[model samples]
Target: MLNIAIAQLNYTVGDFTSNVAAIIGGMRTAFARAADIVVFSELAVCGYYPGDLLEDAAFLEQFEPALEKLLEASRQMPKLATVVGTVRRNTGAGKPLHNSLLVIQDGIIIAEYHKQLLPTYGIFDEYRHFEPGQQTACTLRIAGHHIGFLICEDGWNQPGRDYKINPFDALRRAGPELVISINASPSDIAKRTLRHSTLGKAAADTGLPILFVNQVGGQDQLVFDGASFALMPDRRIVFEAEQFSEDFQLIAFDEGNFTAAGGAALPIPSQGLSTEEFARRQIILGVQDYARRCGFSKAVVGSSGGIDSALTLALAVQALGAENVAAVTMPSGWSSEGSVSDSQTLCANLGIPLYVHPIASLVQQYGAGFKDAFAAPLQGLPLENLQARIRGTVLMEYSNSFGALLLTTGNKSEISVGYCTLYGDTNGGLGLIGDLYKTEVYALSRHINLQAGRELIPEAVISKAPSAELAPGQKDTDSLPPYEVLDEILKWHLEGRRMPQTEADAAYGFVQQLQAGDEGRQLVKRILGMVARNEYKRRQAPPLIRVRARAFGSGRQMPIAAKY
Candidate 1:
């Protein structure tokens, strides 16, 4: 039997001092638990997805000291073996570095394993920085058992797939008693289920008990949920860690079975959190981590009392606390009474202060100035956009003076169709609900109210029609389709390929039915055209917390000034 500790941790990218400190601290905790070995998530030393920082010589120079620190710490706990991820100089003709795992015991490096599968699709661009390591199964003997190692993407190459190499196949042939896989996998709608299915099948096929560790917390647009788990040879998950948060656990592995710390049988949940719960946890962690990492403790949101802004404020308060989150209603001449009153009610309910900053005067000045400078009246669509820009500027002033991070309130539906104003309503340091479709925003709002067991986000706010409130009697339906229809259309156009099979099939059927009619077909064409034309606006928008399978920022790449 081998006693093992899984450290599912959060790491700051390129902050080696904190990263090393965390690793050392975890090692001490593992030793105290009387475990033979402790495993950390992928790239825990420097955090995951460091992007081009891997090419910097100065950045890479600090890694040796960090590694030395880990090595030195391992000497104190001579009986404890530590498996950690770090970048190592490749010293070959191809890439400059390799993503590697180092095993240390008794202050000596026992074995080194390099990642074989470097994913380059979607948000991953591993091929740009690190070269693939030579194909091999690395096994180490510890406590009368042989253990194998695999990095994040290394174990993903299942047999009968198109990939030329399967590391699991090689590792299984090498006959290890167990396999340990470390990952920095990001969270999405179906990510946890996908990981469970993939790893569960691998364990069943190889007849090897598997321990998986993952990193948690938000780094820019990506949030990694730490749903780390251990699987038996029969594909049964015996032990699991907390989801969307940092978790640490020690387990015993013997006879292809996993037990809790001190050899007690582990009780595991058969199903994970509901979809709404998963998204809620993911966004909250994303907001909290992003704020802390970017050196802000407080957040400021331009609240229009619409669903998007209401949900954004609620989430910000949930992550940063009501005292740390403030909402400002920058109302204009066209702003409705409920826009301000509902915002006031919502903020009061949550115990947060609300600031009423009317933008009517500012809008008048901008209109007059535009007429003077451009020799034409800034009326019609430009005039309405001017109101949004004035409000955005006011919010920016608050953010700058108060040193609070600005949270943009645009939902995925508006963002997709270019219904938002760039340099206006789209201005922020980060977007709280930008990844959620309009319908999902409403659903999350209701979910939040249900979770709170009351109308924390005022009933008026939830029932009100969503609008920019920049023009007289403006309604979203006046410019775009109803949210129910628009969200479906956007889902089909933007995330069709990545959507769930049932959803994708449904979206396909809906689009086909729409194409049968001229008006519906033209509506689809116009929405697609809007999406294509708005790439530049999205390119300039702040990083949105990704909660879906395909989000705007890095997940989807499109050319702004090109025709499809």
Candidate 2:
């Protein structure tokens, strides 16, 4: 029997002091449990996806000392072997570094394995810095079991993925009794469930019991949920860790069976958090880690008393305490009374401070200045955009003076159709709800209020119609199709084959029905055109906390000057 401790920890990027301490702390915890081996997530030393930080000479130099510290720490528990993910220099050709996995016992480096698959698409640019490792498998004998190693992307090459090399197959052929796969998998809407189905299939086919560990926490726009688990050869997830938070636990493996460390049974859930709960948790962790990493404990939101900003403010208060969240309503001459009153009501419901900063005077000053300078009256769309820009400027001033991070409130529906002002509402340092469609935004608000068993977001804010308040009698429907119809069209066009099969089928069916009429067809075509034309605006917008599988940022990259 082999006792393995799986450490799913949140590591700060480039913070060698803290990361080294965390790795050592995990080792100590495993040693106290009398475990034979301890496994950590991929790139646990310096954190995953360090981006261009690896290019800096000084940054790369910091790893050697960190590795030495880990080796020194291992000497204290000679019977305990640890597998840690770190980076090593590639001496010969190609890129200069290799994403490496090291096995350390008694302060000695026993075995080493490099990640063979380097993903380059969709928020991954590993190929840009590290060389693809050679096709091989590394297995070590410990506690009467042969344990094979795989880095994050190594085990993901299943049958139809079209990758040239499959590391899991190689490890299986090597005849290891157990496999330890380390990952830094990010948490999206369906990612956790997808991981279970895909990896469970691999385990069943290979006929090997597998132990998976993942890093947790947020790094910029990405959030890693640490739902590490052990899969039996029969495709049953016997033991699992927590999600969206750090967890360390011990599991016993004997004769291809897994149990708790003390030989007790383990209960694994058949399903994880629901879609709405998953989105809520992902956004909360993303926002919390992003604000903490960027050196801000407080956040400010430009509340519009509409669903988007209301949801944004509600989420902010959940992440940072109500005392740490501030709301400001900048209503203009065209704004409705609900804009101010609803914002105040929502803030009061959440127990956060609310400030009213009317932007009608600022809008007039900007319009007059434009007319005097260009000898032309600023009217029509330009005037509306000017009002948005003025509000954006006021938000920036408040942010600079108050030392609080601004949270943008644009939803994916508005962001997709280019209905948002780039320099205005988009002036925040980070966005809380940009990935959620307008419909999802409303769903989340209601979910929050329901979960709280009270009106945390105020019913008036959620029930009111959405508008920019930039023009008289302005409503979102005045220019765009109803959200019910428009959301389906955007989902079909933007998500396409990436969405779940059932959802894709429904969206496709709805879009096909809409094509029966000329007006509906033209509306879909116009929305698609707006999405493509707004690439430049999205390219410059602040980073948004990603909750969906395909977000607007690096997950769905597009060219600014492309035709298709």
Candidate 3:
């Protein structure tokens, strides 16, 4: 029997020291567990998707020393083989490097395989950095068992895919007893289910038991859910790891069957989290890691007593404890009384301190100065924008004074329709819910309350009509359609084919029904135009935690200067 250790770890990009140390630590733990081999996720060395860091000579220079250190560490545990994902210099006529996997034992490299497929679409641009590996299968023998190897995207090409090559076919031809695939797959809505369906089918078709390992952590706009698992040809997921966190486990493989480390039956995997719970955990991890990496221990948000800000504050508190999160309510002349009172109640319920910073004076000064300088009254859209800008500036001042990261509170709907001021409400280091639609924002907020079993977010905040509160008695509906209507339209326009089949079909049908009527067609045209015109604002906005298949930052790329 061969004992295989699955190491699902969290890695920080460009932090070679911490990453290598983590690898060595996992190796020692696996050795202690008497495992024959330990498997780590893809790009474990310098972290996954290092982007332009791959081009830096100095950054590339660190890999050699790090590898040497791993080699030296391997010498100490010669009996245990280690499988690691990293980068290597490609001595061929292509890109300067290749995404590589290495198997090391006793201070020597035993086997190596470069990743075959490099995805270029939807937040992945592997082709821009490294050359693809040759279309071939790699396998190795250890402890009397034959094991085939695959990088992340290699295993994605099933029988009927459009790719030129199928690595699984080559692996099948190699006729290994088992297969091990390493991945750095990022998490999205329903992504876990998709992984299971796709990989399970691939496993059954190949008639090979497979071990899939993945990494977990937040990397800027991306968050990886490490729901690693072992799949059998019988279409069963026998072993699975935790999601949204680091996990390690050992499984014994004998005669193409997997069991617990000590030859016991594996426990069945749970059904997994709901969509809302998944988003909450994902955003929490995103905020935690983003703040920890960016050197901010505390976070602050401008509390408008609306669902958006309330939810942002609640999520920030969950990520960094309530003591670490602060709320500043900048009430203007047009602000409702419930704005401050509701914010106080929300923060009080959350156990976080609330600071009331009235922005009415700041708005007056800005409006007066603008009128005097420009020789015209600042009374229309500019006046409303001045209020948002004043609030933004006050929040920034608080952030600067307290060394807290300001969290932006615009949802995807408002952002899509250019309902936000560029540098005003968008002035923040990171966004927690910018990828979620206005309707989704409410759904998640209600989920939070239900999960807490109390009114953690005041019901007044959730039930109140959505508004910017910049102008007197202004509601969001005054400018745009209701969230129920606008969200579906934005989903069809922004996500389209990228959304899951159920959502895509629903959104498409809703849009088609709207297009059938002249007024609805005009509204759709206007909404589309608003989304197209606001590319500049989104381009300047802070990076948000991505929960959907197609988020704004890297997933959806559109040229601002071009006409549609």
Model 2: lDDT equals 0.89
Q: Report the backbone clash tally of model 3.
A: 0
TM-score of every model? 0.98, 0.98, 0.99
- Tens-digit lDDT track for model 1 on 1-564? 788999999999999999999999999999998999999989999999899999888888999999999989999997899999999989778888899998999899899988989988778999899989888999999998899999988877775474688889889889998999989999899888778778888888888888889999999999999989888777777778998878888888887678886778787645888777888899999999999999999999988888788899999999999989999998788888988889888998788999988878888888889889999988899988888888888999999999999999988999998999999999999987888998888889999999999998888888878777777888889989888878888999888868767778888888888889999999999889888989999999999999988999988989888996
**Backbone clashes, each candidate:** 0, 0, 0
- Scored by lDDT, the top model is 3
Q: Show the lowest summed lDDT stretch of 10 residues, model 1.
A: 155-164
Residue pairs of candidate 3 with colliding backbone atoms: none
Candidate 3 residue spans exceeding 4 A from truth: none
lDDT of 3 by residue, 236-312 (tens): 89989999999999999998899999999988898998878988999999999999999999999999999999999
